[model samples]
Structure formats: C-alpha cells, structure tokens
Target: MSANAQMVAKYKNNFLKEVQEQVEMGEWVKMCMQCGVCSGSCPTNFHPGWEHPPQEIFMMIRAGKREEVLTSPSMWMCTSCYNCIVRCPRKLPITHIMHGLANYAHRLGMAPKMQPTRHFAKLFWNNCVKTGRVNELKLSMGLYFKDGFGQGIKNGMAMKDVALGLLKAKRLNPFEMLGGHKCKDQNGIHAMLKKARELEEKRKAIKAAA
Candidate 1:
C-alpha cells in the first residue's frame, strides 16, 4: 500500500486522531470552541483564498472531513501573524496548529500542488538548508523560474529595476549564482541537522506506537 493508504488504515480513517498524533502541536486542536474569533481576527480574512478559516478548519477536523481539510489551500494561506492566537478566548496556539496542518498535509502529499505558499516554502527551505545560509539571489531565481523559462524571463524583466537597486545597495550579489558563502562549519551544521531529523523521526515513531 502507499504510505498514505497505510496511514489511513492504521488510523482507521480517523483523521483527527491522525492529526493529533502526527502533526506538531495538533493535540491542541480539540481546545477550539468554534467562536469564529480566530476567523475574524485573521489578517487574511478578507482574502478569497481563505476557503476555511481557523475555526472552520477545526470544525472540519472534528467532523471527519479528512480529504477536504488536508487538500484545501486554506492552511497554506497563513502568514503566521498570530492574530488568531492572541484573540482566541481558549488561548489556542492557532498559528502553530495552522502551520502544523500545512506541514502534515505536505508530508502526506495531500496539499494543493499549485499553492504558491507551499511552493515558496519548499524553495526557501531547500535553498537555506543546502549551505546553512540563504543565497538570496539563487532563492529569487528559483522562485522566478518555478513556472517556466518564459514566465521566468518575464518575472526577471519585471523585477529588473528592483534587482538593480539591490545590486547598487550591495544587497544582491550576482556571483552567488556560482557559489555563495556558506556556514563556516558546514559538516557540523549538516551533522546537527541529521541528528535533529533522527530525533524527530524517533519521537514520531514513539507517538505512532502509542
């Protein structure tokens, strides 16, 4: 069976339980009281892409709408402004839960494929993790070229003035395209990240077993 299928069977299709056990800080999802305060407080509340706000997401989880919740682009829309968390009467860690849901959906390969936020997040994470530092130039190029060469050229041209300004300010380095500066202790950084991944996997395994 596919990993997702196996997980579905293992969880007996109980998406809420799966989320609670698998997602970061997901156990707190039950604390939501459906007051709509979180939805109202969101800065992106006016955004049409927000198909379901925080409280609605929690409600969907409780209602067992697994596919709808996981595949929706709503979670990816969070900007992590934390307005929902601050205004929530239950004091729920709403920001963490939203990100947790997004991460969980990504891991299961269930997130919307074309979601811009998810795409940018993947690009940013890969760019930074490689050298333990961000190569801003390469990151920007990657984003520009994500659609196609034609679109990428257009994007670059459109941002040419901004790029030139950055170059003049010494903020953008063209040489970074070749190889940019990296962390001094590259091996140490890689080792530390590897160890962290191992610990995280072990923790998840224990949670799954429990």
Candidate 2:
C-alpha cells in the first residue's frame, strides 16, 4: 500500500477499543443526528480551537478513534455551560460526557496538551492537599497576571461588583478573602482524590497491556 493508504489503514485499525475506553458519558452514548445545534447553542463555541464540539467528539468516540478523541484538547476546552444538554435532540447530557472524557484522559495521563490547565489542576491539588479550600484572592490575582489563564481571568474586575455587594452586606471581609482557609469538606475531598488516584493507576495498567 502507498504510505498514505497505509497510514489511513493503521489509523482505522487503532480506533475502536481505545475510543470505548473513553468511558461513556450520560446519554451521549446513544445515537445522535449530526445537527450543529450543540455547537450553535454553546456559549463558548466561539472560543479558540479549544473544543472539538460534542458532535465531533462523540462521533470520534463512536468510531473507536480513542487516541485521537482522548488526545484532543477539546474535552478540557469545555466551559461546562450545559447549553448542549438543554438543546440536544435526544436530551443527552453532552456536558457531562465532556467531563467524563476529561476525567478518563486525566486518569490515564492521556489528557490533551493543556499546560495551563494541568498547572491549574496542580494548584487545585496543592490547595486541597493543604487547607482544602482555595485562597481565592491569591489564586485569582495570580491567574490574572499570568498569560493563558483561561476565561476565568475575565472575571477580574467583574468581581469588584460582588465584593462591593459583600462589603455592603458585611458577609465577607476583603482581607479575610486573601488568606487561605481550610475546606469545610476537606476530608471528603481527600478521600475522593485518593480513590480516584487508585482507580486511575489500575486503568493505566490495563491500558498499557492493550
């Protein structure tokens, strides 16, 4: 076979089980019409090549192109807006599936290239590993000054509105918000992370075998 043909053949051969290993999410496993509603309704669909659209990802998964599906940064690109879920013809919770893919990828270390996201996840781990809850002001401000901080950075000045409201109500103190606080559910978060890590390790071994 020509090199191009050979490459195509290999790609097809490698897609099946790998895609199934992505873990089914919500009703996304069911049949779907190739309508662009999900993409149209998606609030962040306009985002940079961040997501591959639920239809495309689901199609790839169904086609068994596991590596391609798993490696796509689209999963992490989801803003979790749930617009797709509300507009689905079959009522599949597309957003949930997106997260499921992300978790699976993260577990297998096959997650798409997302240095900033991984760094954010590391921050999450660091905070949870320490006090449980994040130090918002620090995390927020730190993220603001950093490039590629995700859309979350856009909320910088917007939060002053909330801060002012909070100050008026005396519900929160600006200084207090700066310091780190232990999570109210620290133990639960710890337990969940521990369990997730263990399961991921087992899955990694299984994947390596295949």
Candidate 3:
C-alpha cells in the first residue's frame, strides 16, 4: 500500500493520537468542522503562501499528512491574534493549536528552514536563556543576520522606517539596544529553565512510552 493508504488504514493511523499526546491544544482539533471561519478570521489568510488554514490543518492532521502539516507555512503564519478562537463556533482554541503544531514541528526537527517566524522564535528563546530577558537589539540582530551578514544588512535597511518610528516613540532605546541588559537573578533563572526543560523531557518520554 502507498504511504497515504497506510495512513488511512485503521491500525497505522496514529497521527491524531500522537498529536493529542504531544500537544495540549491538539485534543480540540477533532472538533473542527472545516467551516472556514477560522480561515476567514486569520489576518494571514490573504497572504499567498498560507495554503492550509486552521481548519485544513486540522483535517490534515486527521488525514495523517504528518510531514505536510509540519512543514506548512500556514502554521507559522499565525499571529496569535485570538480572532479564530473568538469566531470558532465550537470554541476550539485555534491560536493555541497553531502554536502547538509549530512547537511540535520544531521539536521533531521537521520545521521548515525558510520560516522566518521560526527563526525569530529560536533567536528569542536563545536571548531569554542567556539573560533571562530579551535584548531587543541582539534579538533583532540575530534574526536579521540569521541567513548571513549581507542579508542582515539588507533586512535592517528594510526595517529602517519601523525602527525610526520605534525610536521616536521611545519604545526602542538606542542605548539599551547597543548595551543590552541582563536579568537581576541570572542563576535563579537558569536553574528554573533547566528544571522546566527536564520536566518537559520527562513528560515527552512518558507520552512516548504510552
């Protein structure tokens, strides 16, 4: 049988089960009705690349299109605006489910390499891990320069207007961005994060064993 056929077979279809086990929000995905309300509510739906909206993604999960669901640009496009959740007749937390899928994709090393949002998320986490806080300058630099120095400069130039607006509003302090900042209790933060990671790993192991 083909891979798709195997996924459709009763015993081989573990996709939904796996999703429910791995992502807290994934349990609600079974309730999706493909009504397209979630898609209509999403701000990113107008973008050309988001082929699978929340409803389609939910159906994909049930259909066991594991790689396609994981690599989909639709999952990465969610802004967590809560619009989908608010409009969902079933009251499914579409925003949370989208984020859960993204995290799951990253955890399984299936995340699409070209996803800028994923890149920013990793950079943001790295910044938080090192200092217990995000230094906007460093985070921005890491994201812009992620591809390379030349790309970074180009990205920076593209955002010049937004940066200038931020500076004018005092939201982006030039001095702080240049100097960076550290948490007051860096050791305590590290210890907490380490414990959290350990617990998360334990949880994953238990789920896998099940």
* Top model number, lDDT: 1
Model 2's TM-score against the true structure: 0.66
Looking at model 3, report the run of 10 residues with the lowest lDDT sum.
5-14
C-alpha lDDT of candidate 3 relative to the true structure: 0.84
When sorted by lDDT, best at the front, the candidate numbers are 1, 3, 2
Candidate rank order under TM-score = 1, 3, 2
lDDT score, candidate 3, position 81:
92
* Candidate 3 error regions (>4 Å): 1-12, 205-210
lDDT of 2 by residue, 1-210 (tens): 899976565356545444444454433454567787887888776777565788888777666566677777777777777888889888887887787787777877877554566556656657557666667666666566565456455766667798688779997666776654667777888898899879866875676576
Number of clashes in every candidate structure? 0, 1, 0
List model 1 lDDT by residue over 7-83, tens digit each.
56433347788888888888899888899999988999788889999999999888778888999999999999988
TM-score of candidate 3 to 2 decimals: 0.84
Candidates in order, TM-scores: namely 0.87, 0.66, 0.84
In order, candidate lDDTs are 0.87, 0.69, 0.84
- Which wins on lDDT, candidate 2 or candidate 3? 3
* Winner by TM-score: 1
